[model samples]
Target: MFADVSGPSFIFWPVGCGDTTTVVVSDTEVVQIDINDKLMADEEGNEHIPIVDELVAKLPQRDGKPYLSCFILTHPDLDHCRGFADLLERVMIGEIWHTPRIFREYEDEKNLSDDAIAFRKEAHRRAERCIEEGGDPGAGDRVRIIGYSELFEPGERYEGFPTNQFYTRPGNAITVLDGADVSDRLHAFIHAPFKDGLADDRNETSLAMRLIIGSEGNTLRGLFLGDLSYPTLMQIFEQTHAHENNSMLEWNVLLSPHHCSKKAMYEDGLLQQDVMDEFADSQLSPGYIVASSNEFPHANSAGDNPPHRKARNRYEEIVNDAFLCTGEVSTPEQVQPIIVSITANGIELDIKDYKLSESAEATLTAAIAKARGNSAPPAYKVGFGAE
Candidate 1:
């Protein structure tokens, strides 16, 4: 079904102030990058969207199983891997991309969140089981070590586990799924979580990458940064420039690290002028700076965690009107997913909603009208919860 579609798309789900991106490589193969499905009770708990349901529905089937080519956990933060163990129970993951520092529970286990611990445990079980059986394993059973931090030396891996792996440290590169085409629509380039910048914080160990999507001669690049800090991002930019790896740095779509956290853009309260200048210098004509969090920071209020106003200004200053926040577009009440399709010409927000029962022709028509950015209120249904 996806084969008919002309280009690759990224459907960023609305999960409050958290992140859950569905990278649709093709109609069939898919990747779920970070998940946050905190349960909500009508009485006491805040209303939260159950994203796993949507992820399972979107994945292409393989031998009757809901098949996800990969499930990448950028880092071990709670917002990144909240319902990961639960998602594993639902679908078959191809391979997991992560770093070793995620396993380190420092300072009496204060470094790792409960969700991170759960995800790490699940990763070990699957990788170990696959090795003991002495055969090729499913996606969930596979773990690809993207980068290592200061806590680990080169070639050091999970404790007591000689499982299958694809270790691509910072400054190195890895093909998407070992050059295994999800649908001939896209490929990936790993970038961050370098050995030199490894610190006790998990955000600094974020596994950043660039998703280059499209056919030959029409590819578009989407840079994905997972909660990377300010100084580290600056360092990465400088290093990439020095090595002449400019292609990896260019972005048609940049997911502002840490959900537009000021900490990633500002030193203390002062804006990093050099960083902002560099960002301004690296636009790919049709670029978009997407903040994957609840309503982006407004000019007035100063927030603690992320979605900071100062960070939003940085993106807005660089990308102009192309800046869009997942929460702002989706709004806070409903938590709608933002689908941006990358075509040969450029990237545009997908007008056609991901309705299971919609006619293809009708969906296409709606998508076109919506792309114009002046369509009336969406009348289509969004069936998101109830997993």
Candidate 2:
């Protein structure tokens, strides 16, 4: 049980691909991330949004006050930033964190991403609406859209948002990670392609972070690396080792990169036997690794080869007990939004009423029990059967 004292509640909503992630650190501090498309009612009384909409709808309303403290748009990708325009109309945003790419002065005559192009158009339209209504265009003092590239550098202090001063740029470039204190509980650290690399204008620039969930001074950790590729992952391994005293290979839970795409593991193609072996041996084990992908037989059906197969092969080679896309965890739609709750006692995940195969459930149960303790079953596993 959580004490009445202020603490954080980690809830990951199911928008798969890209959606909102809410973090409630007690009654006063609430943070909502990347609100995608809004809910729309069809003629026959059908709603268009997914399960995450239901969760957002349940957020308690306050008396005409802003309940949200932060809104982070990791990148300008349509899947990631689609709902930001509409969301600004409903929620009170304290700080807007984004990459300078949103307002970058790119001189290339070639058009940027069509998705980003469309989002920019909508952003302008929304800004016009806000101005017409005599509302604050800047969204008040707290509502500033600052780029991550603006002030983030190794050894530099991120002091703009005093509340979240728990960030540091530990390398020579623009990479952000949790300060010593933040890493102590929610161990979310950015380990990846540095600022110099992000300037190359490649998907490798995708924000790479590791989230460790455990109580202060506890032995539990969970790492989430968002859509990172092999080159980037290798760079992270090197940088983290040079910066911190620990190894990057150490993590309790890992979310597979690029939805388990083989390209993430291989540069040229899967047929390259040398690349395959290197990836196969690089796998980390005795921990929970999740692939947030659809239940398709192949990774990319249209591609010459797929990474899904290579990912599975690599897992089999390294972590024999790792979780693969099978039964419930196999299908993205069937995969439940994972909710990680942490307290002084230990850590637990509330797998929303998801359909879990006996083996998958057993693996998860054992992993949790082994990492935390042998107490009663977690609240999320109440009625779930391992058989």
Q: Pick the lDDT winner.
A: 1
| Candidate 1 lDDT tens digits, 193-297 | 777656646677788888876666666677888888888888788888998987778877788888888887788678788887777777687778888776654
Worst 10 residues of 1 by lDDT: 378-387
- Per-residue lDDT of 1-387 in model 2, one digit per residue for the tens? 121122455544433334345655445445554543322222222112243333334444446644455555545655455555445555555444444345443324234444455445444343344434443334322322322454323443222333232223423221222111233334444454366664754455555554444445544444444455676666666666677634434654555665566655666664434433433443434355555443436444546322366666665555534554322332333444455455565544455454434443444344444535433422211110000
Structural similarity to truth (TM-score) of each candidate: 0.80, 0.60
Best by TM-score: 1
In candidate 2, which residue pairs get closer than 3 Å at backbone N, Cα or C atoms, i.e. clash?
A: 154-169, 187-212, 262-307
Error of 2 at 144 (Å): 8.6
Q: Identify the runs in model 2 with alpha carbons over 4 angstroms from their true place.
A: 1-12, 23-52, 60-66, 105-188, 218-220, 247-249, 270-286, 298-307, 316-336, 343-345, 352-387
Model 1 residue 334 distance off true place after TM-score fit, in angstroms: 6.1
lDDT of 1: 0.66
